[model samples]
Target: MSRPAQYHLLSLPDGSWETVSCLASVIRCRATTPTVIVDVSAVERLTIDALAVLVRKAMRLRSAGGELLLAGPGPAIRKVIERTGTGPLLPDFYDSAAALRALGDDGRAWQRVELSEGESALFCEPAQSPYCRHRP
Candidate 1:
């Protein structure tokens, strides 16, 4: 089957410990596409625990033959990633467009699925798990 021509976006709330914990739980239960992008543009501050969540997500993706790219992290966030020595493990981009190109996206407007609390999951599976709506 052909890969989905889009990137799934998991938008962070505030990069707080509580929010990151919630995100980690949701991700474990939900299956995402091979190319998932975690957008941190809205994150005003950066925390070590929060950055750990991103690294953990990336490791999971790699095991499943996928990749996780961070998008729109400011200098503060970048410093944490570097300080934590996860820069080599986690590749990031200044924006989604740059990330798309790096992933070989044809510069077309691909679809997106933004994950957040309160809202329905962009990709969710039942226990038996026949399908997920956010494939690609």
Candidate 2:
């Protein structure tokens, strides 16, 4: 029998390299999964560094036969994704459920993950580098 497509709901923090790095780590952990829907509803601002991570990761995931999706980005953030040339790589959805539905899933059997700012610090390099030290 064919395996069911797996989905992860990753709720991101404010658009900072530190916090976004933690979110990136989580996505790395689930690299083999079929889909990851990032919840950006709470993020009022999105940094280019954070957007770069999403674009890079999304490209890698697509190459590996998986996909990374974004959900609930506000008008400003949405415009950024598009103008930055990442809109093609990272498809934006109205919400997590909408992303799931687009993938032909019921969108009910997904796992949700979130990381706080304190937890994100653990994923950053010492001295508060401009970027997370995660390679690949």
TM-score, per-candidate, Cα-based: 0.71, 0.72
lDDT winner among the candidates? 2
lDDT tens readout by residue for model 2, 1-136: 4334666678886888767876676555433354678889889888899888888778766765667888898998998987888888889989888887887764445554443323233223332343334444
lDDT, model 1, position 109: 60
Query: What is the alpha-carbon lDDT for the whole of candidate 2?
Result: 0.70
lDDT of 2 at 57: 73
How good is model 2 by TM-score? 0.72
Cα RMSD for candidates in order: 6.1, 6.4
Model 1 CA lDDT for position 68: 82
Clashing pairs in 1: none
- Candidate 1 local distance difference test against the native: 0.68
Error of 1 at 20 (Å): 1.5
Number of clashes recorded per candidate: 0, 0
Question: Deviation in angstroms for 132 in model 1?
Answer: 13
